[model samples]
Target: MHPPDKNPHDMRTAFRREFASPEVWITRTVVVGAAAVAGLVVVGFTWLAEQALGLFKGIASVGWWLPLLWTPLLCGAIVWTTRRFARGAGGSGIPQVMAALDPALSGGRRPLLVSLRLSLAKIGLTSAGLLGGLSLGREGPSVQIAAGVMLTARRWLPRGSGVSAHSLLVAGGAAGIAAAFNTPLAGVMFAIEELSRTPEQRNSGLIVSGIVLAGLIAVSVYGNGTHFGVIHPGPIGLALVGPGLLVTLVTGLAGGLFARLLLASLRGTSPDAPSRWRQRYPVRFAVGCGLAVAVIGAVTGGATYGSGNEATRALLDSNGHVPGGFALFKFIATWLTAWSGVPAGIFAPSLSIGAALGHDVAWLTNYPYAPAVIALGMVGFLAAATQAPLTAFIIVMEMVDGHGMVLSLMACAVIASTVSRVLSPPLYTALAMIQLPPRRTLPLATAGGDTDDSATRP
Candidate 1:
C-alpha cells in the first residue's frame, strides 16, 4: 500500500499539537517532582543543621583546643576530598554553576557529577569548617550541595528522565535556600531571580514549582513568624534619616570597596596564572583559618565562629549591643574564609558583619533607631557586595522580619545597590571572567562552501 501524502498545513498543525500538549505534561511532572525534591532538601538541610548545632555545642562544651583540632581535620578532609573527587567543590559552587550554564561548558561534562561531589563535600566540609571556627555561612554552600544532588541524580537516572531530574534539581536548590534561612518565600524568589537565571531558560516552570514547594516545607519547619523575632518595628522618621542614610552610603562604599579589595587581594595572591593564589590555596586557607581563630577568639571570646547566626541573635537581643570592632573582625574572617578557597559562603557572614557594624553604630551613638540602622546596614552592605539588591533585600527582610522598616531598608537598598554597581559590577562577574574560555574563530560554511562571514559571526 502507498503511504498517504500529507499537506504542509496538516503537517504544521500536527507539529503544533504535538508540541503543545507536552508543555502541560512536563509542567505537571515538574510540579510533582519539585515537591518531592523540596521535601528531600528540607530533610537534608534540617539534618545538617541539627548535626552542625550538636557538633558546635559539643565543641563549646569542651576546651578551646578541641575546636582548633576539629576544624583543621574537617577542612583538610573536605579539601582533600574535593581535590580528589570533584574540584568544583573548592569554592562557592554558584560560580561553577554559572560556568556550567555557559554554552561552552554544558556539553563537556555532565555537570551533574560536579554538582553531586560538591554537595557531599560542602556538607562534610562546611560542617567541619564551621567546627574549626572558620568564618563561613551554610546558605551559599547549601546551594552547591543541592545542585550536587541533582547532578548525581542526572548521572545515574534513566536516559529519558533528564527533564524530570533537571526540574528536581531546581526544586532542591530552592528548598535548600529555604531551609538554610528558614524563609521559604525568599528562597523561591532567590531561585527564580538568581540561581535559575540561565542562558538557556529551560526550567522556568519546574524551578518556580520547586520554589513554592520548598517554601512550604521551610514554613512548616521554622513557623510562620519571621526567621528572627524582630518585633520592634519603629516608625520611619527624620530621626533615622541622617544616620541611616550616612551609614548606608558609607557602608555601600565600604561594602563595594571591601568586596573589590578582598577579591583583588585574593586574585593577586593567586599562586598560579589561573589563580595567583591557587598554589597557596592550601596554605593561604590555613593561614586564614589561623587568623580567624586568633581574631574571632580574641574579639568575641570564641563567640564569633561559623556563620555567626547565634551571635547575630545575641547582638539583636542586646539591642545593637556588641563588642567594639567585632564587625571588623568578622569581615576580615569572612574575607579569609572565601579567599582561602575553603568550601563555604560569604553571604551570611557578610550579613552578620553588617548587622554587627550597624549595632555598634547605634550603641555608640545612643540612638533609639538602632534596629532600623542595623537592619538597613545588614541588607545594604549585602546588596552592595552581592549586587543583587532585590535578592538581598528579600533575604534580609525575611531573616530579620524587617517588614516595618521597609521605607528605610528600601531607600538604603537602592543607594547601596546603586553604589555597589557604580563601584564594581559584581564580585561573581569578575570571578567569572577569570575562568572565561579563550576566544576562538571557527570557519563558517554555507550550503556549498565556506563563507567569509565566519570572522564576523558571533
Candidate 2:
C-alpha cells in the first residue's frame, strides 16, 4: 500500500540515518566512556582499601598492645578530619546517593552529598576506618565515589543534552557494584531495585549500556572470576530442603533483629546511658568505639577486624573454623563502628556475620552441605538487612556462583525479607529519610497584614 518512492530500501536508509544522528551518537559515547572511567576509579579505590587494611594488619601482628594505642589515635584523627572538612561524607554513602537522586529531598543540594571533595574524603576516611580495625566495608563508599565521577564527567557533555544526572548516578552506582563484586547482573538488578524505581521504557538502554561497559572494563583488569571462589554443591536433592528452611528461619530472625537494633539506634530510641552519652559527644564516642573494637580484636586475637574478608573466605573454602563467639563479637563491633558516626559500610561485615552463623548452624546440626547452608544464610541475612530480596539473593548467588541453589536462595531471601519488613523498614530507605529536610508551613497573612491564627485552619 506504500507509494512507489517509499520502498523498503528507502525505509531502511531512513532508519540508518536517524540512528546515526549526532545527538544519539554523542549520548551513547558519553555513557560508555563515563562507565569505563567509573570502573577504573572503583578498581583503584578497592586496591587502596586493601592496601590500607593489609598495612594495619601487619602492624597489629607485630605487638599485642599496638592496636590499643593506635586505634584511638586513628579514630580521633579520622573523626577530626571528617568533621573539619567533609561533614556530608561520613557513613556508608548509600543514603547520600539515594538523597542525591531524590529531587524533593535534595532541593538542589545534591552536590553537597557527592562532590569531588566528598568522594576523596570518603575514600581516605573509610580507608582509615579499615586501618583502625573497624568492622566496615569499602563497597558502599565505592558506589558514592563512582556516582561522583560519573556526575562530574557529565559536565563535559554539551549543554541541554538528552543525558540526565539521575541516569548517570544510577548507572554509576550499578557500575560500582559490578566492579566491587564482579557481578554484572546483580549490579543491574540493584540499579532497578534500589536506585531507579522508574519504568524500563525510560533510559533503560543507557543504564544497561553503562553497566555493561563498566563491567567489561573491570573484567579486563581483574579477570572474569566471581568475587568469592566457586563452590559446587553438587545436585540438589530433597535432603537440602529441611536444612535450607532452618537456615531461612534462623538468618531471618537474626538479620531482622539486627536491622531493628540499627534503626532504633539511629532513631535515638535507645534508652541506654552509653547511647545517650554517645549522642552527646560524638568525637569521644568515636574514640570509645575504636577502643572497644581494639578490645574485641585483642580478645579474639585479631579475628574481629577489618571487613572480615579473610574469615569469610576461610569459611567459604571450608578450610578453617571460626570460634563460636566470632559472629556475636563481629556483630557488636560492626554495630559500634556504625554508631561511631564514621565513614564505613556493613556489606562485607554482614556477609561475614552471616557466614559465621551458618558455620555454627552447620556445626551444631552436622549438616552434610555446609557450603550450601552458608550461602543460604548469606542471602537470607543480607535480604533481611537491606529488605531487597532480589538484590540480596542475586549478589550472593553471583559471588558464589551458586546457580544450582537458585530456588533455595530465592526462598530464603523472600522469607528473610518478609521477616525484616515486619521488624523494621529497609535500612537504606530509613537512613535516606534521616537525611531529608523536615517539611514546614509558613503562616498565611491577611490583607490587613495580620497573620491568621486559627488553630485548625486547613
Candidate 3:
C-alpha cells in the first residue's frame, strides 16, 4: 500500500498534527490566560480613561478658562515624561505594534517597541491625555497595551508550541480590539486587516481564540452590550442611496485629508516652522498643541475635547446637537493631539468627527437622515483613515448593532478607503515603516508620506 500513500493533504494527518502535540494545548492555555489578563487590563484602562475625562469635566465646570491652563501644562508634562521614560508609549500604540511585527525590523527593535514598561506608560499617559482635555481615545493605546501584555507571555510558552511571537502579538492586538470595542468579529478582522501586516498570521485559530477569549470579558462585563447601542437604520431604498453616496464622498475626502495631514504632522514633508517645532521642542510643542485644543474646546464649549464619546452617542441617538462646526473643530483638535506627540488614540475621535459630518449633511439636505447618516459617516471615515474597509464596517456594524445596514456600511467603507488611498498610503504601515531601521533593500517612496530615507530625516 506504499505506507498508505503518505499523503500530506490527508485530514487525519492534519488533525493529528494540530491536536496531537501536547505543546499546542500548553500554548493555548497560556494564550488564554494572557488574554484574560489583557481583558482585565483593558477594563481598568477604560475606567481610568473615564475617570480622567470626569476629572477634566470637573475642572472645566470650575471655570471655562481652566482648560487653557490645565491642558497645556499637563500636555507639556506628559511629553516630558514620555521622552524621559517610555517614548514607545506615545501615539496610539498601533504604529509601534505594526513596527514590532515587521520581521525585518523585529530582530533588534522589538524590545524597544513593545514591553511591560511601555504598556504601563501607555495606560497612564493615555489617560493623562484625556485628563488634559486632549481629543484622544484609549482604544488605540489599548491595542498596544494588550499586545505588550501578551508579549510578556512569550517567555513562558512551551518551546515548539507551533505559535510564533508574531502570532502571539497578533492575538494580543486582536484581543485588545476585542476587549476595547467588545466586538469579537471586528477584532479578528482588525488582526487580519490591520495588525497582521506580515505573512506570519497563518495561525488563524490562535488569533480567533484569542479574540473570543478576550472579547468575552467585555461581553461579560457589559452584558453583551455594544460600544454603540442598537439603532436600526430603515431599509435601504432609493431615497437613502443618494444621501449615502454623498455622505461617503464627503467623509472619504475628509478622512483622506485627515490621513494626509496626520502623516505630514508625523513626518514633515517641508521645512515648515510648526514641523520643526514638533521635532525640536516636543514638550513645548505639546503645550502649544494643548493650548490650541483648549481654544478649540473653549470655542466649541468642549465639543472637541476628550474622545468625543458622548458627542458620538448623542449624534447616533439624536439626543442633542453639538455646537456648529463640530466636525471641523474635532478634525483640527484630533490632528493637534496627534501632533503633540502625546499618548492618545484617534479611534473615537475619528468616529465622532464622522458622526458630526453625517449629522451636518443630514441637516443641510433636510433629508431626515439622522441616525442612519451618522452611522454611514462613522464607517466611512474610519475605513478611509485606517484603509481597512472590512474591519471598519464590521466594527461599526457591531457597535450600532445595525445588521440592517451591513451592506450599506460595507459599501461606504470600501468607497471611502479607496478615496483615502489616493491621498495617502496605509496609515499604520507608513508610520510603522518610519519606525523601522532604514535599509537600502526596502521601498522608500510612499504615496505622499515621503518616507524615502526616513531614518536620515529628522
Candidate 4:
C-alpha cells in the first residue's frame, strides 16, 4: 500500500536489523573471540609448562639431590600461596569446573571457581609443580584456565543476549582439551562424557564451533601431529591379542585401584593413617609428597617426574627399555601428588604410568610389539581412572596415531571402564559432588506477602 513513502532511515534500520541482529552478532563474536583467546592461552601455558619441565630436568641432570631440596620448598610455597590467595585453584581443576557448571551452585561461585584470578594462579602454580618435578600434568589445569577465559570473555557480551553461560563453559572446556591434546574429537567426547551431565540441543552447536575454532588455532601454532609420537604396528597378530587382553585386565585393575585410592584420600576415607594425617596437614603433606616424588625421581633416574610426556614419547618411538620399577615408582609418585592437595592433573602422569606398565608387561612377556601394548595400557588406565571409555580411547588413539588399533583400544577401554566402575565411583563426579553444598529451598513471596510450603519448593 503506497499510502505513505517509507522512511529511508527506517528502511536502513530494518535492513540492518535483518542482517545484523544484536543477538546473533553478540553471540557469534563472543564465541569466536573466546575460543581464540582460549586457544592462545592453552598454547602459551603448555609451552611454559614444557620449558619449566625442561629446566627442572636440566637441573636434575646437574645433580640428583637438587630435586630433593628444590621440590619440597617449591611445593610448600605453592600450597601456601594456593591456600592464601586462591583456594578454589587447587587440585586437578576439572572437579571445580564440574562444580561450577551446576545451575544450583554456579550463580555466585562461578566467579570464584573460574575467573581470571584463578586461571592465572592455576597456570603459575601448576607450572611450578612441574618445575619441582611433581608427578602432575597441565591438561586438566588447561581446561580450568580455558573455562575461566571464556567465562570472563562472556561478561563482555551485551546484556539480555541469548548466549548461555553454561554452554560457554562447556565449549570453553572442550576447546581446552582440544588445544591441550590437539585432539578435537577427544575434546568433544570429553565435553559430552565428563563435563556435560545432560546434553542440550542449544549448546551442541556452540560446543562444536568452539572446539573447531580452538583446534584450528592450536594446529596453526603447533602443527598437525600426534601429541605422543606415532607408532606403526605392522600387523595385528593373534599372538598379541592374548597379551593385549592380559594388559587390559592388569591395567584395568591397577587403574581402578588408583582411582579408589585417590577418592579415598580426597574424601578422608582412606584406611591408611598416613592419608588421614596428610589431609589434616595439607601444606606439610604437600611438602612430604614432593619429597617422595623427588625420591622416586632419584630412584628412577628422573623417569618418574613431571608429566611423563618424554618417557611416553620415548616408549612410543620404539625404545622399550624403561627402568624395571618405572611404572611402580611413577604410580606411587602420582598417588602422592594427588594426596597433597595442590594444583595438579593426573592425565599425562596417568598416561605415562600406563605406558610404563605396558612396557613392564611387554618386558615380562617378551612381547615384540611394546608400543602397541603401551597404547592399549594408556587407553585402559585412562578409561579406568576417568570412567569414560570413549574419551579415554579417543585421546590415546589420537595421541599415538593408532588408528589401526581402534577395535583393540575400544575393547580395552570398555573392559577397564567396567572394572573401574566395580572398583569405585567416577573420580571427577565424586570430587564435584564434594564441592557442591547440600541443596536448600528458598522461600518465595505469596500473593498475600506470606511464605508457604509450596512457595519454598524447588
Per-prediction count of colliding residue pairs? Answer: 13, 0, 0, 0
**Backbone clashes counted, model 4:** 0
lDDT (10s digit) by residue, model 3, range 269-289: 558888777666777888999
- Candidate maximizing lDDT: 3
Candidate numbers sorted by TM-score from highest down: 3, 2, 4, 1
lDDT of 2 by residue, 1-458 (tens): 85666444677777775586676677677878888988888888888899999999998989979999888778867876776677678778887778778766443567767767777888889998888888898878888888888888677766755567888888888888888877788788888889995534555787798887777777788888877889866558887777778878888888888888776765543678866765566578779888998999899889889998888887888777666699899989888787777788888888898888777777777887789888888888888888889988998998898998899899999998998888888888877655554444422111100111231133
Alpha-carbon local distance difference test for all models:
0.62, 0.79, 0.84, 0.82
- Which candidate order results from sorting by lDDT in descending order? 3, 4, 2, 1
Higher-ranked by TM-score: 1 or 3: 3
lDDT (Cα, 0-100) at 284 in candidate 3: 89
Which window of ten consecutive residues has the lowest lDDT sum in model 1?
A: 443-452
Overall local distance difference test of candidate 2: 0.79
Q: Which stretches of candidate 4 lie over 4 Å from their true place?
A: 1-20, 269-272, 441-458
lDDT of 3: 0.84
Cα RMSD (angstroms) for every candidate in the order listed: 8.8, 6.5, 3.5, 7.9
Give Cα distance to truth, residue 302, candidate 1, Å: 1.2
- For candidate 4, what is the TM-score? 0.90
RMSD of 1: 8.8
TM-score of each: 0.80, 0.91, 0.93, 0.90
